[model samples]
Target: MKYRIGRVLISEGQLREKVKELGAQIREDYKGEKVIFVCVLKGAVIFFADLLREMGPEVDAQFDFLAISSYGASTVSSGIVKIQEDLSTDIHGENVIIVEDILDTGLSLSYISKLLRERAPKSLEICVLLDKEERRTQPVNVKYTGFKIPDEFVIGYGLDYAGHFRHLPSVHIAEPAE
Candidate 1:
């Protein structure tokens, strides 16, 4: 079941521009308040790092990492969200943002949002680098969206297929190797 990286779906330049825009939007929305960015681990780590840099020193942005897994070694999600790691910081009464790599069926993020909301944060929102609306099964609100992509198995830029291609600078479709 080998796979090959296909055409660029989102270029590195596009991602950088979108991240900057999202950072600006977040700064404006939060209005100089402190923000706690909870990075969804593994896939979102790369996007999280790049996004954080956009925040700059002027913005009081704090960050933590939590690992959630629905896809093990498969391209498609297993539909069961599991928390491999949890955030150490208490999010109660704080401006919290969940940064994710992609929103597909929306199961993982929906589950995560529900759990976080129960913690009673002052605000809870989602920021995703990619949104695949065609595959959304659960309704989840995404406050910041980098790109609305089509229904394709995409890789690169923190997205991956069976744990490969996550380090690629740009996003690419994951197609059959042949």
Candidate 2:
């Protein structure tokens, strides 16, 4: 399969600034307490890395990675989520934040949230880099969103298609091959 960049939807500078802003907000929201940042792996790795860096020293942040898959080498979601990996540390009685790459159908987040809630976390919230509300089949309350984008197949900045385009610094719409 071949793909082209349709257009740059979010520039690197924009992502940087927004991440910093979100980090500041998170720090303020969870001040004087240790917060566990649960990064949804693979896609969210880039966003999670950059976001944590901007969080500064005041926020007592711990980190873990969870790998869940709803889309596998495809542009569309299968509407089913599978947990490929789970958190290493217990989140019980801790302020937990799930950091995701995108919130599309909300199926994955919904599943993850429900599963995590059962663990008795003191608090649980979601932070996504992108939200495609148009494609949402299930409702998800995102505490922090970097961008609200159209229902387009986006790739780059840790988003990918068939395991490609994850290295692009900016987010772009993936154009189908002619």
Number of clashing pairs per prediction, in order: 0, 0
Which segments of candidate 2 are over 4 A away from where they belong?
Answer: none
Per-residue alpha-carbon lDDT of candidate 1 for residues 131-160, written as tens digits (9 for 90 to 100): 999999999999999899999999999888
Off by over 4 Å in 1: none
Locate the minimum summed-lDDT window of 10 residues in model 1: 51-60
Q: Score every model by TM-score.
A: 0.97, 0.97
Let me know the TM-score candidate 1 reaches against the reference structure: 0.97
Against the unseen true structure, what C-alpha lDDT does each candidate score?
A: 0.92, 0.93
Candidate 2, run of 10 with poorest lDDT: 51-60
